[model samples]
Target: MAIGDSVKPAAFQYHAPQSVEEAVQLLGMFASDDGRIIAGGQSLIPTMALRMARPSHLIDINGVGELEKLSVSDSVLSIGACIRHAAFHRPVVGNPLGGLLSFVVKHIAHYPIRMRGTFCGSLAHADPSSEWALTAVTLGATMIAESLRGRRELHADEFFVSIMATNLAEDELLVETRFSLLTPGTRFGFYEFSRRAGDYAVAMALVTFELVGGLIADVRVGVGGAEDRPRRLPEAEKVLTGHPPSARLFEDAAAAAAAAVDPMEDQQADAAYRRDLVAVVTRRALERAAA
Candidate 1:
């Protein structure tokens, strides 16, 4: 059955392809000012249903065989674009990232949603409040995208452009995401504050640090759900990079994180509230990483 017939209003034509090459060709066929690619129908389906997004053609990639792998290597973890959130919750798949990422994934939206939502789908949707986007950016992950022309790799910093927007082209498909494994002796922490569990986070913080002979060798921190986009706080990282992790250093990092981010006011929180959360969450995350 046609998607228009299945879904009311007949907003557009739909094509489901069985292979990546076929999907790419279908995308090319509908290469116009208003064509969109659909995967998992987790985010795009809802948006289309609301008519918030109206594409002349919907190229469904669910039947494509190339986008469903998750493999780990010596220094990197590679996940295909279509790998579902439930797949990520497996012990083998989720345990390596210090168990912190796994904790966050368990709280994303709901079980039914997680069962259908794909990691790359979440990243491509580019919701700043999304756990996947927030965590990936904090960890300095890489995103691989493919088009009829070719494939390109983008660092997490360059992949997300704004709220609900990304660097992907209309005809391009996100193929995989890669994350560099934290070095040995690296301490890691991930924390987010929300009104209740399983709801969108008000502010989220991720911290990674390397301790070299009891002194800090490197540090990185990222904050999300409190701004227009997920962002790394290099200033905060700089403050703690060489210093030993302590209460004073944690305070300094918290101050730096607060100063670095200019969060927007939303119905859930005000600018001042979000700024305060940045400090609180950053401090807690640093303390946990230090521990």
Candidate 2:
């Protein structure tokens, strides 16, 4: 049988490639013909099932062993495309970044979803409410996109374009993401508001900062689910940096976050409600970090 002949195809063809080079070649051939790369399929499968996405070919990358790499090297945590969310249940490295990932991974839907969903897949999906995406933007992670053409590295700020969208080209696959390990004694916090336990977040915040001489330094505040994409809040960071952690300062930072964002409005939440949620989540995250 040919590569995709076994599966009874209604409209799409499936190809499983065992190596990264093979997959890239297939993508180069089929991307213009609506070929998509499937890893964990946490989001893509459902969309296909509902007939929302009608790709003619799916190049499954789960069999690509090279894409399953997860390691810490050169003071950075590198997560490969096939590394599932469950891998982060325990600290993957002996650093604050590992602990922070462990804490945030639990909020990524329920247990079963975590078992199959890949970290790189989440970033590729680019959901605004995704916990991993928020963490990536907040931590200044670098995304590596590969293809038959070439390889390119993108910072989190430039990688994500909007909800369920990214700057990745049609023929490119997200191969790996590198997150710099947090320094020792760094403080971090994350909080989100959702309608139910496993529902997508309505609004969320991830905050990190270091203290020097009892004053905050290197502060980063990221807000998500309230905007088109997860992004660091410079206005909020400005309020927190160089200041001692206090309830008043946290409140001010939260206010700045709320003021800075132009929130998304939908059936679940109006713009004003989302703005309020931004303030609440931002304040709560900052409080948790300070504590």
Candidate 3:
């Protein structure tokens, strides 16, 4: 076969479901047939083009009107599966979470990719360098999955397993994801390092905390791309809690984060380099949050 023919995706049947129940039913039917769901098609399309993923059936959920819902209620922001990353370009609500999302969303790929990529799709993709995945883990977001079996909720800690993998079952669809709003007085800071402007982050950090009586409280420090999965660094958070926001304290927290992670290494970066980046990004994010 020619190289061009080898790169092309295999023939597959397409199914467009207009409702959540219908989608779940189709998924159940095709679960054993290597069926896959397609949303923004940002990540999957590229893989498909290279013949890395050739599902026998492709389930399209964009036509489902109910899945496009985006709302803030009961102190939580609910993002549907069809909600694009571009949706967060503006503050979706009057809360700090919206602003934080707006700030981070700009770091995802390029303008065209943002217009077509969905927020939940990023989480479902589960790339270690994904900005949205780091944000979701930092905020302790909840993932809602639906299938013919039933509906279930998975916390951020439980949702992500490893690089490009999640707890999502073969027949389950990620219907929605919800994030608890950052309360008043909560400050957020985020920083990432990459080779180029639109490239995936080699290491990134997100920090959120509230100041009580001039001391840090409710601190959350999340590190991504440096490890197999993005996660909260309790060691770093512990270093920050009850401390005043000072350069010394931030550096201490950054050091704690650097020590805590078993950094991932690839052709572009070594383990030592990734760990150093974790320290740098963590400190920068803490500085921004404290600003």
Which model scores highest in TM-score?
3
Off by over 4 Å in 3: 1-6
**Between which residue pairs do clashes occur in model 1?**
none
Candidate 3 C-alpha lDDT tens digits along 46-84: 999878999999999999999899999999999999999
Per-model TM values vs. the true structure: 0.91, 0.96, 0.98
Evaluated at residue 178, the lDDT of candidate 2 is 97
Model 1 scores a C-alpha lDDT of: 0.82
List, residue by residue over 19-99, the lDDT tens digit for candidate 2.
999999999999999999999898988887666888999999999999889999889899999999999999999898988
Cα lDDT of model 1 by residue, 205-239, tens digit? 98887888787876779898989889999899899
**What CA RMSD would you report for each candidate?**
2.8, 3.3, 1.5
> How badly does each model clash, as a count of residue pairs?
0, 0, 0
State model 2's lDDT.
0.94
Put the candidates in lDDT order, highest first: 3, 2, 1
The TM-score-based order of candidates, best leading, equals 3, 2, 1
